[model samples]
Target chain A: MSINKLAYYPGCPSDGTAVDQDMSTKAVFEKLGVELVEVEDWNCCGAAEVEDPKVVYALNARNLAIAEKEDLDIVTPCSICYYNLERSNKALKADEALCTKLKGIDSSLDYGGKIKTKHVLDVFVNDIGMDEISSKLEKKVNVKVAPYYGCYIGRPPETAFDDPDNPVLMDKLIELIGGEIVPNFNYMKTVCCGGPLMMTRGDIAFDMARKILDVAKNAGADCISLACPLCGMMLDGKQADIEKALGITIGMPVVYITQLLGLALGIEPNKLGLNKNAVDTKEILGKVV
Target chain B: MPIKTWELDPNFKNEIMGEAGGERLASCFQCSTCTLGCPITEIVPSYNPRKIIQMSLLGMRKEVLSNPDLWVCLICQTCTARCPQDVRIADVLSAIRRIAEREEEAGNLKIDSPRPLFDKAFQHQLEKYGRLYDIGLAKEYYPKKEGSFIKGMKAMMKDYKDFGMRMFKKGKMGPKAMLAPKVKGRAVIKKIFKEMGEE
Candidate 1:
């Protein structure tokens, strides 16, 4: 199951907050001999907050429709995007009424529901294979990494490619790349990052993030590695705020899973956008570099 | 609180079941599994999923729809994943929220949270540019408060100063990123939104 090329959907945040993820994903994949072609003119997948099913289905169907034209399976790094796109793809295929309604939206845009939507993690682990990934690694990462698998990547079971309760693709990938997995990470791996409620309920969101960081730090993790941009926004972007609000000094560096993989592949730090992390990644990068 | 049979809308659960994500609403048997696994409920004890399901089942329409706890869900689907009844608790909540949004739009009830505002702004960005424009979203999401646009802007800046500064320093957010290119199929997106009646 070697994938040579994939249609990439760099969800909204990749263009902004998670730019590091966008950069490192491309860098690591290119090094692994996989080409990621951007899905042409893709739109937002209504990331979790959009409660209206009609709007959610319509938005995701548009992206799936565009990807169907590429004649390639779609892959996204963002967990929310992966879940929504796959959910929409499944619904659009299973529900004939949805397909008809979407057709009414744009007659020229027809999705035969032929394409499979995959998260990049699934592609790297299942399609590319850990053996191939390890062969490409120029450096074996030595830092202790807490592999954080936020919510969307493993929820609702039906759309998830990995185990919803205990996903090991990330752990396997990190281990293959020579990063040590934290012993206590399993408990907090699937916990919510409180991302969707960050805006409306910062108190709860911060507290939730605080717990994850505390667990990671307590387990002697050098850094936390994750997939979702929203999780990165909460864990990496808000680490400082959580510390200040809670009157605690976590100072835990959070890195995108791709960024860590990029480093292990000997891609330059700048190429991986390591410096873009709000929590300084220098300490962990120093150990690997 | 005493039971008020006269105020209950017996068809409320049926109404929820009619919604796209609510097809399984009637299957929940008060097992309390969804509430037990919920992370939000752990922090805010009052925001209970099982209770919401029970209320909807008993046809407590206004009480369920107008509840501010409705928006507190992270929609992480932990409960949905663990539900023995396959209730899809998160999606059911979302379905209820859709009704709440409509109710608020019709001026029948008021939602306390600004989450709906943010969602609208998010959808607006998608419909207008076919992708999210962070700055544009910020401008739309912050409350405009009558005529004090400058005051509102100041407040937002104050709230976001630290976070925005970090993003700006990393070259992730700023005027340059705001002017980043839009997708080529804006027209198609607008047409999709219009057709979906989301416009």
Candidate 2:
């Protein structure tokens, strides 16, 4: 595990609504003695739209430019943010024309597209090393957890951090960092969370998450560990609406992956950014801690 | 939250995302496992990881592609992998993109998309070198990057920082991409794409 630092890309969620998530990410990171540098003037991860490849690239390029300028590997907390940043970085790196255009827009920026972007969980597992995190485990969240990686980061390892179909980083991180991951948890291996919030037509998105939760419930997972903010917002935010809408209850709380790390590191739940979560982790932690 | 509304086909709402992947779409159960699993969905609100599949199932092809979800996906396949029901979220989006591109090129559809140009540019790169080269692609993508001082400065600085910048090119990886494999029948691969209606 590298002891020095983590170049952080808080992205959209980390600043406000996901502040809790951000806090915990910092706590765990600090506990590991890693210096965290926020990506300066980082723009959105092209989250709102993909209309202009030019604009989209510019947006993602802005973040990459910061990462390159600072000469630090980026560690984003949100899955979607991580995915887009890394994906765009990968794409821009490949299409020199795209990178050039992006560089053109930012005349003063050095947008070389060589910086490697990773999810916070990735830094924990890869850079921090689960073994170190495991060594620091003062307490274990015996809570049965279904580690949810979401889509963007894992698969297309070329673009993101790890393998999509069978991701072991989070699984390993959870265990080493002092938590339990349900190995055979049924829905642990699935796709998007009713993507883009079929919220209006939520019947589509709702049903998808509902099924996975059911699988977790069936598998006895008291909670699910997450890497993406949208994943948390949707799963945690909409859990009640989904439960009422679907006439079922998962009772399974959704918590940020970093929060778990913080807890393991003896960082209190509240200070570790547990508050930002839509679904409370209290009961789950109560049972585990 | 500036909402940019467009004049989508009047028939858009009446149709559903194609049924090919609808049942799986219906199973979304919204664990957001897909959304959580989806890396792109985290950054961009414009692209809905789950909605396109639903739109596809609803046969809302026009709506789905035109939604920006098609282009924003990054084709990471995370949505499909995270989907419990095994919904081909990315595949459905890919098909929608294919249809949208065909429609735009044929002028049957008018989309507020720079993606067509992006796609065309990508195609041109593929055709020229049978692979996408970053240096060449950059010159092709942004003309300003060619002779500007900022471009020169950035390029030199980037090269200085990351030594591998020169070798950074799309589709230049994996043994197969570097050299189009010698198939037992190269004609077969050609025929498949041709029959599949790909160039």
Candidate 3:
């Protein structure tokens, strides 16, 4: 069954930092019969912390303006992009004077506030619905996954895509794929991964990243499954760095939730960009039936 | 140890309240919930969110503006989510950082840290190319930052050796895409930044 096409906002990471996320997102969505229509000529979301809120507002507003012109709900695999897009839209709505000034900044573009920003996790849980997703799984992925939601998907009560305190969206998705969630760990829901800030403060970042890894490892998780690419970058890309910094070998591989889902859907592992992960996933894959 | 009397600037709280996103300053009731919920506080015990709010309300202007902890927040909104008073501690801290930037510019405050320089470099890169180029950022940021050419180059090469080689092999960075790939609507983004006086 074919679902309606979404205006996919393949944020900056899609091109650079987290290409595997982009590939798996596309592959899994295609298999699920949902077509992703890339927003034409999209700009960077300016993930770095800016001095002025207006700069971030304007940056995200441009992307929203582009999608509004296309008339489709925007979907993104990156949590920061989803958060910024949603924050910008809300900022515009709150202050009319600021919104008017922003509109006048660029005469060529229009910030109509027409589109709704949805995280890919939300699209899977709410839009695609679990029934359809479960029926499509070709094989049972019996791996134990520590579902790391991070802090972005749900927080700031006003603009959350899921429950802020206890988000079960990823847990449900994990079970549907025949993966077991690490039982009864409240800290698994909303831990900070020290993203973006990791660039300058590797010490703090490694410490924070280590805490998440320690929890998952203690819970006997075979791997960590996450939604945000920034989390993926920290957990997967910096997994080795964290090990070196902490002087402990955490052999668990960090895989994007979509990649794991694609695996359960029986899509070829290479097609999901499983090879690109910094932590080798081959040993784990060998164990999975 | 000598006892110290903090000359309370009652106007400091009012001044912060006057800034954008800082209007909720009066709502905080000295509940330490924000500090308890903060992840940074767990590692860096001296950096306390609830204490920072108390100090800000009590008019600790010089201390609040100059402290490096002001910039350490990830702005993850964890504190904001848990704050019963809707104090928006993250926004308040961000506002303090903005004041710090202004003071640093006027030479009233001197910061010995990498964050401000790095932030300026990130913003400048966006202004020039409408996106972050790591190579460009390193070129533009490191010299003045390290206060010497040799140290800057050494630092940059060390960073490249650590993660750059891996990122390059992963295709996250390359000569073609990282150097000069096609940027769509560069003029429009530049104009947006320019009009905002961010240029």
Candidate 4:
């Protein structure tokens, strides 16, 4: 089904660290003629760190309840939010007792678990369709793009829309924009970027990110295209840190899937917040523009 | 490194199964798939998911709950996705961590990692503003240790100085970003916390 509208859950980081992702996503959707209505009074989705299942359920159910009221499928760019929201929705639907407890929190907060929570990439690849997206591309991006899926978007298998082990939605989207897919990225594509532990375990996180960056760099890719803000933050925002810590030079530019899409669709670089990215995109942009 | 049979708490497995996301704890047959696919084990060889599960099943409640290695799993769910027995290895680890958190609260144990501290700060921001306030999170997270404010401030700056400067230069963090508005559902957030008995 082609969705013309969606209840957008921007999540917490979108306003600050991931502002570029938010802007680019909105610009891409607007260019595609899809209306994105913000989820009314949406709260945090109780990201992965929250171990208490009840708390995770309560926090996400509140947002799901609000989106349900909008009577539209919910969509978010952050994979962590997408995982928490979708997992909570599925759990709430299966467990009546948990749903009853959530209702006790607030009568209006009772989520029917009816709305489908989707990653923006899922919306772009499936709902929006590859043909429609390819038709909208105004510029042919002549660069080797390594598509990074990170972890959440296609893990735990049950909630994934694409193949959990070997996802190709982002690669398909990359192809749609006339970008070449870096060879041999399948093995490292879905490898964990160590995002959840980045703040607390910077050593391990940076090493894991370095592994992915090394794979991309060795594959001769011009840039990395991804969907999640956390991955972008780690791979792009912290690329310099990884280099300093590991004493290796990896100058891969990490661009969000939406930003790349927006670029190919003729959106201005400023509108896509291209300048906001930490790793310079001048090299890739020069080839495309 | 030796297992004392008498020290094992047989009901520890049951305790784990009682927790949410731990329903399938008993289903694990030690296929070692979780440990194989775990990215952390590759980096930190000492942090092994299979060993953790083996210890839990052997009834090493105190050892399992208080183990500092528990905090290093990253909760990436790679193990959960690959578990042959459908043990939901990641969720099982979360369940064990939840127990560990409770034990720490009761003064029975101590966690070495600053992850729990960060998690609390994250929750505090969620409860206060209905969304994360990055500046507020930093303020709450730092200066929360057993030290003077100056020490905590120094540590925070030392860790984030270079990264913060880069983010600032790129316009990702600044005064305007600092003043970003909070969600309007603070009341609802408070109620949710209260309902979940987390408040």
What C-alpha lDDT values do all the predictions have? 0.86, 0.59, 0.80, 0.86
Candidate 1 docks at the CAPRI level of medium
Predictions' DockQ, in order: 0.69, 0.06, 0.56, 0.73
Who is ahead in DockQ, 1 or 2?
A: 1
lDDT tens digits, residue span A1-289, model 1:
4689889999988878899999999998899898888988788888876677677777888788877888889999999999889988888889898798778768646689899999989999988998888888899788999999999777988887877889898999888888899897798999999988887688999989999999999999999999999999999888877888889999999999999999999999999999999999898878884
Better of 1 and 4 by DockQ: 4
lDDT of 4 at A193: 91
Model 1's lDDT to the true fold?
Answer: 0.86
In the order shown, what is each candidate's alpha-carbon RMSD?
1.7, 17.0, 2.4, 1.6
lDDT of 3 by residue, A1-289 (tens): 3347888998766766688899899999998999889988777677746656677788877788878887888899988878877888888767777778877877545587777888899899899999899888897788888988888788877668888888889888888888898875557668888876775676888898888888888998888988888888888887877888789999778889999999888899988888888778886576556
The local lDDT score (0 to 100) that residue B64 gets in candidate 3 is 80
Interface RMSD of each: 1.6, 17.7, 2.0, 1.5
**Candidate 4 TM-score over all chains jointly:** 0.97
What residue pairs clash in candidate 1, if any at all?
Answer: none
For model 2, give the interface RMSD: 17.7
Across all candidates, the chain A TM-score values are 0.97, 0.91, 0.94, 0.97
Which 10 consecutive residues of model 1 chain B have the lowest summed lDDT?
B143-152
Please state the error at residue A263 of candidate 3 in Å.
1.1
Runs in model 2 deviating more than 4 A are: A51-54, B1-199
